[model samples]
Target: MTIGEAYLRIAEDRFRRVKGLGDGTFRQLSERDFYERTSQHGNSIAIIVQHLSGNMVSRWTDVMTSDGEKSFRNRDQEFEPADLPMDLILEQWEKGWETLFNALRNLTEEDLLKTIYIRSEGHMVLEAIERQMAHYAYHVGQIVYLGKEIKGGRWESLSIPKGSSDQYAEEMKRIHGKNGG
Candidate 1:
């Protein structure tokens, strides 16, 4: 994969993987469950998702020609809790990812080195991507951490459960070895 494609792949994987953990075992939490402990300094997963989506839409659309931070984006409002259902929160999550995928889908190899600006500073497309990947990862980490903490014992493991890593790896290799050679 091209560097851009690789970055996009990693970003998509990390985002979805984190979200999946919440959707299954931790789905019992309400909007209040998500927002209750977070202070003003921290945002809820919904806000983080909204902000991520907004950033993706701004950065990826007209990427080379425009600022990554949109002129019309209400960055602050993203932090304010909306009295919407958890379903709406999921919609925002999906829409944010869709916006990102839509933008990433249009990229070409030539676009990698193209110049883009964010907050009036110039960044190569790859640099912008690295920046965004890091940003999303920071938030995804937050999402997963919060879900795990909130669910406590009820939370299911996202990777191999507890002590099964070796077995999981061996199983994967065994399953693939016969098909390949």
Candidate 2:
């Protein structure tokens, strides 16, 4: 693959993994737990997801041609608590990801070098992608941490389980050998 294509491939994989972490974490929480904050001033998963969805839609739609911060986006309102159903929240989450993936899928190699605007600031397309990837990853980490805190002893490992480094290493070695051959 070309460098640009390789970057997109890696980016798409990371985005998929991040979404999987979120889906797994959310599955462990009760509907009411989605709105529960770790602290009085902290944001709930609901608010975080809302902000993510709003950001994804704003940044990805017409990504190459228009400003990433859409005129219709009410970014400030995303922080406020809402009583929306859990299903709606999840739907919005999926919708945002879909928008992002669609935009990424349509990007040509040349598009990576193109300038994009976010709130009147110009950024290379690659830089914009990295910026959103980092932003989403940060929030997804928060979601996973809160879910683990709430689940406590009942929490499951999203990656390699604790105290299993040897087993994981062996598995990776085996897989690597197969691919190498």
Q: Which candidate is the best by lDDT?
A: 2
lDDT of 2: 0.94
Ten-residue stretch with the least lDDT total in model 1: 17-26
Candidate 1 lDDT over 112-176, as tens digits, reads: 78888998999987787778777876777777777677778977777789889889878987988
- Residue-level lDDT tens digits of model 2 in 59-134: 9999999999999999999999968999999998999999999999999889998999999999999999999999
> How many angstroms is residue 33 displaced in model 2 relative to the true structure, after the best TM-score fit?
1.0
Full-model lDDT for every candidate: 0.70, 0.94
lDDT of 1 at 161: 91
Candidate 2 ranges with C-alpha deviation above 4 Å: 178-181
